[model samples]
Target: MEFTQLLERRRQRWTRFALLFTLFLVFISGLYLVVGEVFISPLEELSALEEQLILQLRLPRLLAALAVGASLAVSGAVLQVLLGNVLAEPGVLGISGGASVLMVLVLFFAPALATPFGFMLAAVIGALAFTILLVFIAKSMCLTTTRLLLVGVALGILSGAVVTWAFYFSDDLSLRQLMYWLMGSIGAASWYHHLLSLILLPVLIWLCCKGSLLDKLMMGEQHAKQLGVDVDQARWQLICAVSILVGGAVALGGVIGFVGLVVPHLLRLALGSENRYLLPISALAGAILVVLADLIARTALDSAELPLGVVTTSIGAPIFIWMLVSHHDSR
Candidate 1:
């Protein structure tokens, strides 16, 4: 009987994995169809144009979508574990807002500093600064999730206000650049972006996997301390890991939201709350969501592509609301 039960459990796990993998494959195939003109009757005759579209447009956008999705998902998973809150994400924690504010400032004051590397540096610095502030607030306020969230929300509002004021006073040329960047696009992606994301993503993944030790810490600080976990050290390391991942993502994709929050929660529901599975699963799920969303963003309208951020928000918000309602009904 025990052996039979074990077999059933393993089968169930594999079934879920297979489902997620199948979804990913379908998303990829759909993206190819939409972006490659494979389904468009008139465009099917134009082989050269199809090749150009696939090579010049679809591939880079897909890569950017993958990077942004994985980063946000991992970052969200880390934050949720660290704070013991289901809703915690990089954006909610003011990390993304902080990065945005700094990038806007750079654009306003020194337009020449708007390169990818420069924007990445500014984003990292901003995320790190806000993370430090959050730590201080959490420690001083007894480290409750509610307090942490409230503080983060306040900081996010402040950062947004700063960005708004800067935009109000900025010149038209820089403002146009800033506006486009804020809208978020994979249209500007290049081999350089792909290479940089490839380098940084693995490092962040490794660090986040290491920091998955925090899932144990989340059981309760007292229990974690008894288990020999260095609570404070683990917290700091996790914060740094999330900062790098979220900052790099925002710098690359410009404030795409909700993938992190939604993907991790969905994975947690499927795979349980063990960060070991949760982190990697969320990463894959996130990559799939972004890639599919980008595909729709490019093709859902006419010749004009929609902003990737707008696409994510439109899709994610409804799903998020449904999740909330379902959870409430279950309770």
Candidate 2:
């Protein structure tokens, strides 16, 4: 019963952490709104100009940060289970690459489809297509571990090649725009873009609720089958859900890397890979991370904002390297 007590205490601690994290998310979100170029106090009555800035600019950007963060984190958590790799994330696995390629093509060649709704739609299609291809290739070849990661890396490289070619032929104006986006920023976010992204909320909820299914999948296919799970059907469903999440995030935030890779991995380490805890916590932590990153991106320099990706990469890369080293040492 000592073991049981230990488990119970651990659960209690995590429950407290989750509650604190939720409040932290709210606090940071409020902080994000008021702490920009013109600091607005929460207690003070808003001026018309302050109202416009908060509602039109800060609010929407905050929403985008929340959505992108939660989506990528949850997707990473699920992909880690599905691929059986701590390293699986939207960017690393080329899911974001797929969405990026389509977005670039559309913005360059079919500029008419560059609207908020159109870009979202294109990104979903691209992500879904690439996810389907990934699943098919993995299944046909029975890819596991290193082979699967190599395949994902290869896919990412191919997408990069296509995007590079597009960049080569683009005009200077278009090239500049694409470069900024590829580096990732929510500085241009507006209500319309956030609204388009919100449509993915239901899908995100559905994914978070799949914790039990992921728990089963984590045990391997034959074992999951023994437990009456339709492993193939479930795999496809999870893949599709991840595609939508990754696509929506890429559409809204442009290829913000490492939120996915880092958040869930950290949570799994702390929370012991019990996905019901891991997934939801991952979402909250991811949202907090991105919002904070966005805040730093905009406020770090008086004259100019940094790219969102640059901030996250700077933060995530060292942790990622640490993870690599720790994993190797453990092995």
TM-score of each model, in listed order: 0.84, 0.94
> What is the lDDT for 293 in model 1?
79
Put down candidate 2 lDDT per residue, 45-106, tens digits, no spaces: 99999999999999999999999999999998998887777887888778889998998888
Backbone N/Cα/C clashes per model: 0, 0
Query: Model 2, stretches more than 4 Å misplaced?
Result: 1-7, 137-144, 172-175
lDDT of each: 0.75, 0.87
Stretches > 4 Å off in candidate 1: 1-19, 22-30, 33-48, 143-147, 319-331
Candidate 2 global TM-score:
0.94
Model 2 residue-pair collision total: 0
The true-structure Cα RMSD of candidate 2 reads: 1.9
* Candidate 1 lDDT score relative to the true structure: 0.75
Report the Cα lDDT for residue 246, model 1: 77
Per residue, candidate 1 scores C-alpha lDDT tens digits across 18-124 of 47766775668455545533454444565776767666766676777788888888888887777666767777677888988888887767779978887887887
For model 1 the local lDDT of residue 317 reads 80
Task: Report the number of the highest-lDDT candidate.
Answer: 2
